[model samples]
Target: MGTGKRRPLGDRYQLISPTGRDGPGIIWRAHDLRLRRDVAIKEIQPLFRADGADLDGARRRAMREARSAARLSHPAVVAVHDLLEEGGRLWIVMELLEALTLKETVAHLGHLPVHWTAWIGFQLLGGLRHAHGAGVLHRDINPGNILLTGDRVVLADFGIAALNGDPSASTTVPLHCAPAYVAPERLRGLTASPAADLWSFGASLYFAVEGRPPYPGSDSLAVLGEAVNRDPDPPVKAGPLRRVLEGLLRRDPSDRITADHAARLLSAILRMEGVAVDPPRLPAARLPPDSFAR
Candidate 1:
């Protein structure tokens, strides 16, 4: 079969149609002959042969990254069903989801209702907390990686995620994560950390409520410069959630709000019965002045 034709993988998955592409992987909607169900398969290919890089090493690293993402099991995290090696390619079989990405929703609907954005943030934080506990840092957290299915929110695309303490985690070829959502530390050449994920989460929420990234730019480098040199434009549509976004967007990792604290504020917003009220103040001790000099 050719690249455009439906191809069988092993004895199970039959590739149907291309769903999307991420970095060096081509995602496909496929059918599982044995299970009689649909799955999303990510085909990992070597993109560096033109540059004289090792193809085998790239394949191995992609496999390792898929395995690391499979280790995370949470309702809000997309489930990885299996990994396969066939036809000199690596495939990650995942649950096929039916929903629009948060990015698409924002594009079509503009700013989401405040309560809806809070609900999405709450679920995202839960998923991130679970990943952090499992020693995985989803280095790329943005609107595109967040999906809305019915009333539930799911986080997808773990291609650039890193293991917390593994040395190899830092050495893998970096996939192109959206620079607009990257944390300031990563822009400054620091390694990916949980704090970086939190910063990206804040940017994602900001996008959800404000209809654009905190730092609006035409390209990645421009956005990186803004992220490094400036504070986020204050969120006008965040309503009672403004404080949570403000806390998470702190330039210093040491000063950013903890995931637990963010969860509490979101819970309060969700539980509020009448008109939205400002979330109770987060403890002053946890938030300090920006450590980076102006």
Candidate 2:
């Protein structure tokens, strides 16, 4: 497709521009012609040369993503509008938001203030709580998948979320996970639970205030080894969040803090510091690398 040309999808959506890549697919900022509104579309490409199993697995994974996300309704959770299989491609239509990803925010500001981090963490916990309540596990949680729009903190990208008790969720093998933020138990090939998500959240929070990931390494394997075999370095800047981080980052899943308790701890920090529940918002234009590609 040329830059001047808009690609139409079944007369319902018109692709404006490709935001970026998402694994084996492309993320597009599209216009819903029928609804006359902007929306984000994840286009999953077909594996042309792969065997039947691989091709079917890809479609199944996409279906799982749509089903997992469609199960929940939360302010902090991004909404999935529809799932379509058009022209041999899987398209996931989602509510589009103008925002900066937590990764971009962190990179732009180096690190966030303790109170702001607390506020974001609190909202994330709320989203996780809702997902868990619905028997969904966000198997992947990291800064890139988090969106900061206005004063609201949104958790996006349920592409790899696991629906509890769904046999298909346990059968598919994950090709990759953000090792720096993945839970230790997950690194050990254990079944993921809400604790795993919390651990990843803790690592993301650690990154928010520290301007770096808790576990350091050059490659994914090295990082996974560090996560599995040792403890993350103590946070020098977490300050009020130190205990919360420690609680969530415990190596043993049984020892990790529950989402509710973590929410309480984060709320306490915000309250003690006299920070407003919804702090001032930053315009997405101010943050560089403005890509809603996750």
Against the true structure, what is each candidate's TM-score? 0.88, 0.89
The reply for model 1, stretches above 4 Å from the true place, is 1-7, 49-54, 171-175, 273-294
For model 1, what is the alpha-carbon lDDT of residue 6? 50
Worst 10 residues of 1 by lDDT: 285-294
Least accurate 10 contiguous residues by lDDT in model 2: 285-294
Error of 1 at 240 (Å): 0.9
How well is each residue in 1-294 modelled by candidate 2, as lDDT tens digits? 573475578768888888976556788999898989999999876544544435566688689788988988888899999898877778999998888989899999999989989989988878777787777788889898899998778888787788655555563325556788888777777777777888899999999999999896678778777877999999999999999999999998888877767877888899899975643222222212321111
Task: Choose the strongest candidate by TM-score.
Answer: 2
List the candidate 2 regions with Cα displacement exceeding 4 Å.
3-7, 46-53, 171-173, 278-294
Score candidate 1 by lDDT: 0.80
